[model samples]
Target: MPILEDLKEYAERATGLHRPGKRQAAELPHPRKPHVVRFRDDGLVPNHPRWPLTLYRSAVRIDERHDPAAVLEDLFEANGWGDSWRNGIYDYVHYHSRIHEVLGIARGKGRVRFGGNKGRIFTLKAGDVAILPAGTGHQCLSEEDDFLVVGAYPPVGTYDECTEVEDRPKALQRIPKVPVPRKDPVYGADGPLLRLWKKSK
Candidate 1:
């Protein structure tokens, strides 16, 4: 709860807003990467212009100390958004090839399920951390009154990086209007990078 309060205070001081649902444009400093963290006041609002129903995202970065799992919990608890839950049920599905994510839980309790098959679902509490391997399907099932989430993406960005590049037909053509599911989950798979870590193992 202290984390949530701190984030709220930071958001208010940064944007002059008391709630997390409102959108406020602010510049965040990242010594390790070039990125921006946009704060929102409305919970139901979407982070992108195309996806209005998609969950709102606050303070995204590539910091090593701030994991995605921990940040997510904090965001949920601070905004009173409830706990994390399994993917493909009530949570958003990446549906794309493969991507890595780090989540932070600030408040409440929830669980995360990774991969379509042979995946693991982790129960997360306040200050808990979860990592989703690339090409793995992930979702969060909320169990608490509210939950806060802070997510981190790789330097290339989640999904395809080509979409952001101008005048790149290859990237644009390869980009899908909707994300596609991976043939297999990245965790426990035989690969040097895939073997990096496991939520359960």
Candidate 2:
């Protein structure tokens, strides 16, 4: 059987058995923290204190049988992440207060700005992933015509849009309280996110 099909079967059986297990992807070397861009509070955006925004490049192997977004959704769900969605980033700036978010670039390329107006920007392509801690601001700067992204949140908290000054206080409060996810979205328990985030905290 093909690998993707085998994964699907394994997932179905695991679900039926009510056991927590994940089918492994092609293992890439663990990403180092220096590759990540950490955004801080820039007044307008109250970035998380305990968590930092992290990005992984060329993290997954891409091929014809797999849609990057679909693969990411499965990877995240296997790692105890939920609330997955398939879409592009919003044109305007926004942040989530109550939950951390992960974005996997499924196709094309795009430039995105993180950490409010003062934050740095990133150019991303297919197979790349970004993990945004709570209260980190992000905006879509530009993208290729075929651009697409998949997003999801950890299982701990509900998601809330925080786009105004009135939302700041509540957002600030919630950012630190959001617990680290049990497993890294793309690499399950052993992924870079677990090492980086746990060390930072």
Scored by TM-score, the top model is 2
lDDT of 1 by residue, 1-201 (tens): 446555655654466443323121111211121121221212221121111111112223323444333334333333322323322223643322223344555455677654322334566555443433333345565456666544443333345221112323332233222232121111112312222222112
Best candidate per lDDT, number?
2
- List per-prediction Cα lDDT, in the order shown: 0.34, 0.76
Cα RMSD (angstroms) for every candidate in the order listed: 15.2, 6.0
Indicate the residue-level lDDT of 51 in model 1: 15
Candidate 2 clashing pairs, residues 3+ apart or interchain: none
TM-score of 1: 0.38
| CA displacement after TM-score superposition, residue 65 of candidate 2 (Å) | 1.4
lDDT computed for candidate 2: 0.76
lDDT of 2 by residue, 51-106 (tens): 67888887766666555555666666777777777778998889998888999887
Count of backbone clashes, every candidate in sequence: 53, 0
TM-score of each: 0.38, 0.83
